[model samples]
Target: MGWLLLLAAGCSEIVFAVSLKFNDGFTKLWPSVVTGISGIGSFYLLMLAIRTLPLGTAYAVWTGMGAVGVAVIGVVWFKEPADWVRLASIMFIVVGIVGLKLTHAE
Candidate 1:
């Protein structure tokens, strides 16, 4: 349950981050609203997860997932670019997340 909440938080973060680009620095209405709602929901879930999971582990996974997710969003939806280096970096984040989960027994 904690892991699921953390993953959801991470996804919410990604959603807010992508919406931020469309927010036009808060000039837009709908995107801005989406960003605000997602940001709040992200933190709420993050807090829920951190209640049971170690703070460091929870935060690391949350941010790691969000980073990878946003980067993929950049490449896929925004066509930002995805060479080998970028792809490898994302894989590293995935490996790190796996490692953290494995090492954290609680």
Candidate 2:
């Protein structure tokens, strides 16, 4: 359950981040609203998840997963550059997330 909450929080973070591109630096009203709401919700869920998970592990998983998801969204939806270096860095983030989850018993 805690893991699920953490993953949901990560997804929310990704949603907020990807939506930022459309926000036009908060000049666009609707996207900015969505970004703000989702960002708040993500933080709320992250705090809930941290209640059960170790702080370091929870923070790593949340940020790492969010970064990977947002990067993929940027590449697919926004056509952001998908160079080999960027892809490799994302892969490293995935590896680190997996390692953190595997080693975190609680």
Alpha-carbon shift of residue 67 in model 2 (angstroms): 0.8
Per-residue accuracy of model 2 over 1-106 as CA lDDT, tens digit each: 7899999999999988988888999999999999999999999999999999998999999999999998898899889999999999999999999999899886
Each model's C-alpha lDDT?
0.95, 0.94
In candidate 1, which residue pairs clash? Answer: none
Tens-digit lDDT track of model 1 for 1-38: 99999999999999988899999999999999999999
Q: Which candidate's TM-score is highest?
A: 1
Root-mean-square deviation per candidate: 0.8, 1.1
Report how far residue 86 has shifted in candidate 1, in Å: 0.7
Off by over 4 Å in 1: none
User: Where does model 2 exceed 4 Å of error?
Assistant: none
Worst window of 10 by summed lDDT in candidate 2? 70-79
